[model samples]
Target chain A: MILTVTPNPALDLTYRVPRLLPGETHRAAAPAVRAGGKGLNVARVLAQTGSAAFILTTAGGAPGLRLADDLEASQLPSELVPVAAPTRSSVAVFDESSGETTVINETGGPLTPAEWTALHDAVDRLVVPATCVVGSGSLPPDAPDDVYARLAAAADAHGLPSVIDAVGAPLVRAAEAGASVVKPNRRELAETTGLDDPVAGARVLLDAGAGLVLVSLGAEGMLAVPPEGEPVHARLGTPLTGNATGAGDAAVAAVASLLAAGVSDPSALVRRATAWSAAAVLAPLAGELAPGFRDVESRIETG
Target chain B: MILTVTPNPALDLTYRVPRLLPGETHRAAAPAVRAGGKGLNVARVLAQTGSAAFILTTAGGAPGLRLADDLEASQLPSELVPVAAPTRSSVAVFDESSGETTVINETGGPLTPAEWTALHDAVDRLVVPATCVVGSGSLPPDAPDDVYARLAAAADAHGLPSVIDAVGAPLVRAAEAGASVVKPNRRELAETTGLDDPVAGARVLLDAGAGLVLVSLGAEGMLAVPPEGEPVHARLGTPLTGNATGAGDAAVAAVASLLAAGVSDPSALVRRATAWSAAAVLAPLAGELAPGFRDVESRIETG
Candidate 1:
């Protein structure tokens, strides 16, 4: 079974407003709440794709309990490590008129030393029989910067394939820890590699010891670089425009699922991952690939 | 003892961002949560003003629990009537560059029949010994629109004064129930009376059997009209400009506090209420009148 870790999970709230006027009160047409974090998104996509995965995360206070309840309501399996402070909440206001989305992400709760130990214990317990482990999203305040790197190292020691989807220093540390795969968007990849050309940045991540590198280019699709194989590319034929919040996480899930299913070909994995990312963009809800996404997967062209 | 009822309270959340870009992710600088509703605001202001009022409201589910925790943390005395569904949460995004505030209010949870019964029982218990009761804010979904009217009637039956702070049909209903005082903003007074002029609107509400009428005009201060006394005019020399989210509620608390203290003069009440309202606007925190706001009350002009 796949184990997904989201250190800084949140209660994701979406408000649908006709138009957002600054310094004005808006009554939302409909409001929705979901359990959200990058690893949780990956776990959700994997579950939807008929894969067995367990979402592991830390949650606290009433908001954290509500987040767990929301996941339960969605029929998603999860195990929560308890903490003292409440989990953070992220707000997304969607304007129907402009199709614009404004996101306000709360900085997640600070993890105490005991809470960190509890999470480490939970992860250790889950890693024993896990075929793959995915570490995603930002670390909470007070958490060590190299926490993801340590988790990746533990996965490597256990012979479990590890996929890292994060940004900035966390991404760099995850790569150095020999993450089986690293998925970073163009902007994050630029920050990581300090390179303007995304293709060159992908090469840098590959050279940094990532067994495989997947760089997502919004609207342009994805680029893939494998350790021992020639690079293959898949670009979107149609502009799949929608909320791209969880597209990268979905791509990580796709790649992990393909690799765990024994698909070793780099080009085939890239083709599948890009199609899943595009499908996620087209879907109304975050982390969900479209119903007929598999049928459209073969239609994607390689560059 | 004073009783303050908030039928539709909210978990008020504020997210501070350096800049808010539509259709993009923005990291929050800080996030804060507080109990919100017109009646709760009144209770908070009353507490700050050295009046110990019992806050009576529905509390259930995650948001409601969080609001209750916040009130407790603030050391405000409260008696929560439990409900099945969670209270609503309102999001305010502050953009520093534009000095713009974007508010997204969630639709409030409707109280079940049992919850309504519990609220009614709490009101019955509080009305017998309470000097004054304040019924404030909008009715939650599935709640009777005349709920405030019923509460006002209960107060009247027990020889207790009820200050109604609501708008539109609810204000009309409370007035019809002979509320001791009704505070409606200029727009709400116009909507309720079909008259744009505050004097005319105040006359209409007095004719509708309201014992006293206080019309709040943002920046222009307040206009008070009593059943038998001359109109009391108390206007702010300097317009209190801020978010203006809970200014009216602060005004209601001032009126309630004065009425409970046996101050029946409309001129003095309006002066104190307007000063408190202005102070609330000046303060950054909702429901809190600034320090030395009582000193400002003495400076208010009453003609």
Candidate 2:
């Protein structure tokens, strides 16, 4: 089974407004709430793809309980580590007119040292039989920036492959800790490698101990760079456009699924991963690979 | 003891941002949560003013529980009637640069007939030896528009003075039920009475069997029109500039306090009420009267 960790999870509240006036009152035409975090998104996508994935997250207070309740209502399997402070909430205001999304992210609750240890313990318990472990999203307050690195190292020690989807110092640390795979978007790749070109940045991550590197270029498609293999290009078979909020998570899930299924070819993994990411954009909510996504997946071009 | 009833209360969440850009993600610099509703605001102000007001509200689900917890944390007295769904949450996004507030209000949980009967029973229980009973805000779903009117009639039957702060058809029904006092802002008064002039609107409400009519004219102060006494005008002697979100509720609290204190003159009541409303703008949060707000009471100019 795949184990997904979302250290800083949230109850994401989305408001739909016709227009957002700076200082004027705008009523939300519709509102929606979802349990959100990068790892949660990955797990959700895995579930949609008919994979057995368990979500481990830290949730607290009423919002946290509500988040857990929502996951249960959605029939998503999850185990929550309770905390004292309320889980942070992220507000996503969607403008249907321009299809632009503005996100207001809350700095999530701080974790106690014991809570962090509890998380490590949970990871230790899951790693014994897990084929793969996925760590995602930002580090909450009181957590070291290298927390993901420690988790990746633990996965490595347990002989389990790890997928790291994060940015900045954490991404650097995860690479140094020998993450099996690292997925970074174009902008993140630029920041991580200080390279103007994403292909060059993917090469840097590959050189930095990541066994495999996947670079997402939004509508342009994806590039896969392996430590010893030639880089492969994957493109969506058709032009599809929609919300891209959780596309990266979908890519990570696809890579994990392919790895777990014993697909060792980087070209085949990149082809499948890019198709999944594109399918996620077509789905309204994050993590769900669109229906007939496989049909679309079969048509993706791997060059 | 003042009995405050909030037919539709909310858990108000305020997000402060430098500016709000439509279709773009904006992070909140600061976020705060508070228990909110017009009657809840009145109860909070009354509590701060050393009045032991008993809040009668339908508090249920997670948000309702949070609101009750907040009230308890504040040491405010309250009696809650449980409902089926969670209370609504209102989002107020304040842009500091433009000093503009955008409100996204959610329709609160609908009360079942059983819940409405339960609330009525609770009101009946309070009818014995009541001083002042206040019903405020919009009617919740599944509840009749005449809910406030019925509550007012119930309070009158028990020789309790009823103060109603609502708008449109609810205010008209509340006044027709012979509310002792009905407070309507200029815009609400115009909407209710079909009169553009607030003074004329006040007279219309008074003619509808309201014992006293209080029309709040933002910045200009308040107008008090009683059944037998001549109309009294109270202008702001001191220029006050602040958020007017809960100013009307603060004014209601002031009127209740003066009535409890046995202030018989409409002119004196209007002066104290307007001053308190002005003081509300100075306070950062709703339901909090500014320190030394009582001092402004004497500055009110009555003509």
Candidate 3:
């Protein structure tokens, strides 16, 4: 079983509007809501692919209650550490006319120290039965930047490999903490490492003691850099044109699944991650893989 | 005591964004939430004025739970009728840079027949101690258009006056049911009665057996049309502007308060409603009048 941690989770609401106009009033039908966060998306994909996954997160207030209820209805196994602040919501307004979506995200929290401690305690309790540990998404403003690093350290003590999918200081901290694998898309890598070239940006993490760095290049696929060896690059022959919101999380799911099963080959990780991500893009919503994902692996060209 | 019915109550969420750009993603802090619907807004104003007001509305699902919690926290008297469908939300994203707001309203409910019957039952059980009945806002999509009319008829049966603040078919039905007062803003009147002239449209409601018609003309103030007397016009000496969203509801609140006290004089109703509506415009949010509302009435010119 893989254990995933989402420091900040959201109740994602999607509304379909006839058109979207700034500074105007719009009336829409009831929205489609889901329990969402980067780690939860990864866990959802893992579960769909027949892997046992458990989720650890914090929620509070009405939106949190709603998220808990949705998780229960979805049959996803999760432990919600209650907090005083309400869970935030991410609203996506899809314009039917132009097929464009406008998103509004509420910056979740400045979790109290006690709330953070409760979350850490939950992770400690749940991590024992997991084969691999994964931590993803943004931290609350007041949360310690070394949150994922602490998770990596905990996983190391447990003799388990860890995957960290995050950005900014947390991503850098995860690398420095010697996480088994760190995943960041091209933009995130560039921003965090201050390097425009994807390979150069990934090397910074590898230099910081990360065992592996997977840089997602969106339609172009992915690049895997090892501490010692030539980087392996892989991608599908035809790029998919669909919702790309969950592609990165899907990549994390693939890497975590392979690592949990004791697959460590750089080329294999890159190939599977690329195929799964492409499959995710073909699906209509996040946290879902297209039906023919198995065939996508054959189409990946690795070097 | 005033009984207010909001067929479709909402959890109103207000977010302050740095700027609002179409087809772009924005991150904002947590939203301010309140129990909001037209009738609830009316009740809030009445409560603030030291009047006893009771709320009757249908709520379900998580948002409903939140609304119920908010009403409880507000210390307002209310009875929430449960239904299968979830209550909807109205989100307002205010752009701090431009000082403009974008509103997204989720059209709530097509309440089941059983749910509608339950709502009617709640009103029947709670209307006994009410001095006046106030039915406000849009009915749910599947609800009978004569919902407010039914409330008026119910009030008549109880020897109480009814104030219907609605638009379209519901507004027309309220008038035909001989509601003591029917209030609609200029735009609502034009759309419902198909007349550009406010007085002419108001006259239509009075001719439909309405005892009185109050037409809110926004910054121009209000016009009162009594069934057997010349229409009275009232306005502040100088127009004060802040937020006009709650102006009409404030006007309805004023009329309800006056009628509850058995003040049936058209000129008095026009003067008070006009002053309160102006005071609401000067207030920053809906369901609140500016601090100097007493002075506002003294400044009103009724002719």
Candidate 4:
């Protein structure tokens, strides 16, 4: 079983409008609401791929209750640690006319020290039954930067591999804590390490004690950098173009699934991650792969 | 006491962002939330002016619960009729850079026949202690156009005057049901009645059995057209500028307050409504009036 920790969970609302005009009023149909977060998406993808998964997250106020109800309705196994502040909401306005989307994300309130303690304790308890631990998503404002780092160390203490998908200080901390794998998209990689070169940026994570670093390059596929030996490159002959919002999470899910089964080869992880991410691009929405994803791995080119 | 019925109440969320760019993602501070609807705004203004006000509205789902919680926290007296469909949410994005706001309003789910009947029954029960009945706001997509007309007719049945603030067919229906006062802005009036001349358009409502038609003319103030008297025009000497979103609701509150107190003179209602609407413009948010609203009435020009 894989255990996923979402630092900042949200009740995501997607509104569909005929057109999007700046500074104008729009009347839209009721939005599509989903229980969402990076880790939750990863867990969902894993579960969809026939892997048992458990979610550990914090929730509060009315939106939190709605998120809990939605998760239960979707039948995702989870435990929510209650807090005082209401959970944040993410609104996406999809314009049918231009085929574009505009999003607004609420900055969630910082967790209290007691809430943080409860979160760490929840992670400790939930991680006991898992073969792999995944900590993903943004940290709440004023939250300690070592949140995912602490999760990595906890997973290390329990002799389980950990995958950390984060950005900025949290991403560096995850690497420094020696997470088994750290996945970051190209933009996040450049911004976090202040290096425009992907290889040089991945090296920062590898030097910081990460066992492996997976860099998603969108249509170019992925790059895998190991602590020792040469980095591996994997890609599909033809890139799939669709909704790429969940591609990164799908990649992380693939790596975690492999690591959970004790497959740590850099090339093997790269091929699977690339294939699953491409599959994700072909599927509309997030957390699901295309139906023919089985044949994708065989077609992936790795060097 | 005044009874304000909101047919389509909403959990209004306001997000403040540094700037707004079309087709771009924004990071916003936590939204400012309030229980909102035109009728609720009218009730709020009435209460602020020391008029006893009661709210009758339908609520459902999570946002409805939040609306009820917020109303309770603010100490507003309200009775919520439970419905199967969740109440809608309206989002306003305020851009600090350009000082403009973009709004997205969800078209609320239509109430079932059972739900509409329950709303009417709830109104019957709640109207016993009120001196006036006020029905305001948009009708749900599939809602019968006579929702406010029915409210007006019910108010007449109880010998209570009604003030309706609506648009389109609902406005026409309210006027046809012989509402004491029907207030619509110049634009709503022109669009609903298909006449560019405000006086000629208002005449349509008067011919439809409406006792009085009050047309809001933005900075030019308000026009009160009574069934038997010549039209009275009232405007402030100098228009105070601020947020004008809630100005119309404030006008409705003023008229309802006067009618509840047995003051039905067209000139008196016009002066009070003009002053209160101008006071609302000077305030920063909806459901509030500037502190010196009493002095505002004295500076008004009536002709």
Candidate 5:
């Protein structure tokens, strides 16, 4: 079973508007609301692929209750760590005319020190039985910046493979803990490492103790640098042009699920992860993978 | 006690952003969520004036739960008639640099027929002991178009003076039900009555059986026409340049609270209502009147 942790999850509300003109009164169609976060998205994709996945998230107030209710109603499995602050809502306005999507994110999770510890304890308990653990998304304000690093450290101590799908200090700390893999998108890797060269940035992360580094290159697909093997580049023949918000999450799911299934080859994992990321773009929702993922996976090449 | 009903109330989420650029990702500031609708706005304003006003509205799902919780936290009085559908959320993006407010209304209240009848019955029960009844806002889809008319008809039969703040078919029907007063903004009045002149449109409503009609003219203030008295126009000395979303609701609140206090004179009612409407714009939030209402009232004209 793969366990995913999202410290700052959101109740996502996506509304489809005809034109989406800014500074105007728009009448949005019925919104599609769901539980959304990087870890939650990863768990959802993992579950859809027939992999057992459990989501560990923090939720509070009414939006949190709604997120919990949605998780129950969905095919994904989850456990919530309750808190006092209301979970945040992310609004996405899809403009039909221009084929554009506008996103407004409300960052939340004002967790007390006790609440943060509760998450740590829950994760500690779940990691023992978990085949692999994944920590994703931004840490809420005031949360110790090294929380993800600590999770990676704990997973390492337990002899469990771990994946960290985050950026900034958390990403650096996770790498320092020597997690099985650390996946950062092109921009995040560059921003956190403050390096112009992507390969150099990945090397920097490897030096910090990561066993493997997967840098998502967007349209160019993915790059994999393993400790004992040659660097590999994987890409689909044709680039997908759809919502890219959850593509990285899908990649994280693929990496975690592949590792949990005992696929130790970094090349095989990157090929599968890149295909799944493309599938996420084809799907309409953020936490969903398209049905054609297997076909897409067959077309991806790693060299 | 003044009784107010909002058949399709909302959980309002307002976010402040430095500037809103369409089709872009925005990191919004902390949002302000509240229970808001025409009737609830009226009830809140009445509460501020030391009048006992009870809000009767249908609430369901998570947003409804949040709205109920917010109402409980506020000073206003309310009772939520439970339903199965979640209440809708209307998001307002306030641009700080430009001082522009963009509103996105998610039209909802897909209330089942059983839910509609439940609201009707609840309103019937509450109106019995009420000093005056007020029904406001647009009815949700699937609800009978004559819902407000029916409420007005019930108020008439119970000999309860009532105010209806609505537009279009609902507004016309409410007028036909002989509601004690019907307030429609100038645009709504002209659109419903198909008259270019707001005064002529108001006259048409009075002819349709509304004992009085108050037409809001934005900066020009308000216009009142009674069944037996000549039409009177009231205006504050200056126009307010703040949020005017709830100005009309404040007018309804002033009218209802005054009627409950046994002030039946239409001219007197319109003067105070205009002042309160101006005060509402001066204040930052809906359901609140600025303390300068008395000063604004002293400068208002009824001629």
Candidate 6:
């Protein structure tokens, strides 16, 4: 089974209103809460695609308990490491007039040294007997800058592949530690490497020892680069306006599942990942591709 | 014991941000979650004051489960009736720059007919031993508009005092049903009675069979009208700026506790209630007064 690590999980809350003014009272429609955190989202999407995945996450206090309870009720397999700080919550206010979402993400509190160690230990144990391990999301404050690097090395020791999706130092470190795959969105890639071209940015990660690099190009679609092969790019037939909240997580899930299932063709992996990510945007919530993924997948032509 | 009925209880999520700009992303500090609803807030405040209060509320699905779990963790005594729809969540975004709180209250879903009956039958049973029965917050759609009226009558039949805190038609009906007390703020009172004067608006409720009418005059303090005595008004030495979220609930709790203990003097009730409400404003959260309440109470004058 694929193993996913979420150092900072959250209870994602979404509120819907007819219009959102700068300073005013909003009588919103009923709010919705979901299990969140990039890695957790990856695991959820993978499971929906008929892949078995387990989530390793940190949780604490009442909100943490609620997250655990939600996972338990959903029957999603997860290992919750306890922390002193409460888990954070993120809100997405959907404005119906403009059909836009305004997000407010709580900065996750730092974990104690002991808490960080526990997370590392948990990941160490989970990576064993696992087909693959993927680390997604930002590190809690005071956490080691190379947490994904450490995880990549640990998985490397076990002769397993680890997919790393992060920004800045963590992404660079994971690549340096020989990560199997590194995925970054266009802005993240540019901000991290100061490169406007996707191929040039992907080349940096590949040169840093990442076996492959996938860079999301928003409506322009996604680009895939294998260190020793020609780069490939794919997009949908037409751009669609949809909620792209967890599209990246959906892409990582697709990569992990395909890699675990022994899909080594770079072109096929790129096409499927692009279609799945697009399908995720079409769905209302994060972590699952809509049924239209089938049609989207067939129409995605890679060059 | 005091019994509090909350027809629309919620999971109260408070997010603290540096500043909030519409349609922009914000990275908030950690959020706080609590069991919230008008009656539940009243019950929580009363319990903090060393008074016994039991909350009767509807709960269903994940959000409801979280609210109940939070209440249990907080050691708040509550009985939750099962319902089909998930309970709602309310968000309060505190902008640190201006120290302003922007609130988004969700419009709770309608309870099934059976659920409404269950809540009423449960209240009828609890009101027997309850010294005071409080009907707080709005009625869910599909519920009888005269629910507070029926509840007041039920409490009256049990020889118990029924305190109603509501607006619009429910307030009018509760007063007509011979409620022991009805608490309304300046706007709510004016809106309901279409009267500009607080005394005149309170007189309307008193004339409709309410034993006492307490009208919160915002910064002007509070005004009380008793059917058997001259009206009384009390104000703090000077109005203090603080969170006024649960001030009304705090006032209701003070009224309930004093009324339950057989404190019948209108001036004493009005002074204590106004001080408690101001104390709530000084506190960080709803349902509990801060230490400044002692000084505020001593400064309160009823004339």
Ranking by TM-score: 1, 4, 2, 5, 3, 6
- The per-model lDDT (C-alpha) reads 0.85, 0.85, 0.90, 0.91, 0.88, 0.87
lDDT of 3 by residue, A208-252 (tens): 879999999888899999988899999888757887889999999
State the lDDT of candidate 1 residue by residue for B206-240, as single tens digits: 88889899989888888899887688889777655
Task: Please write out the lDDT profile of model 1 over residues A87-183, one tens digit for every residue.
Answer: 8888888889999888888888799988888888888999997888899988887778777887788899998888888877888888888898888
Question: Model 5: DockQ against the native?
Answer: 0.60
Which candidate has the highest DockQ of all?
Answer: 4
| Candidate topping lDDT | 4
Error of 4 at A190 (Å): 4.0
> Model 1: what is its DockQ?
0.62
Candidate 1 to truth, TM: 0.92
Interface RMSD to the true structure, each candidate:
1.9, 2.5, 1.1, 0.9, 1.3, 2.1
C-alpha positional error of residue A56 in candidate 4 after TM-score superposition, expressed in Å: 2.6
TM-score of chain A of 5: 0.97
Ranking of all candidate structures by their DockQ, best first: 4, 3, 1, 5, 6, 2
Give the per-residue lDDT of model 5 (tens digit) for A40-138.
999988989989999999999878888998999985777899999888889888899988888889878579989989999999999988999999997
Model 6, residue B281: what's the lDDT? Answer: 92
C-alpha lDDT of residue B28 in model 6: 75
Q: TM-score for each prediction? A: 0.92, 0.89, 0.88, 0.90, 0.88, 0.73
Q: Which ten residues in a row have the lowest lDDT in candidate 1 chain A?
A: A22-31
Q: Write the per-residue lDDT of candidate 6 for residues A1-303, one digit (tens) a residue.
A: 999988888888788888887545688776676778899889988888889999999998767887898899879899999999888888889888988888898878789988888998998898887888899987776678888898888888988888899989889999999998898999899888889888998899888999889998888889999988799998888887888888999889988888888775778777888999999999988887887776888889789
For candidate 2, give the lDDT of residue A242: 87
TM-score for candidate 6, residues paired by index: 0.73
lDDT of 1 at A216: 84
Clashes of 1: 0
Q: Candidate 2 residues A200-261, lDDT tens each? A: 88777777788888888888899998887578889986788787889999999999888777
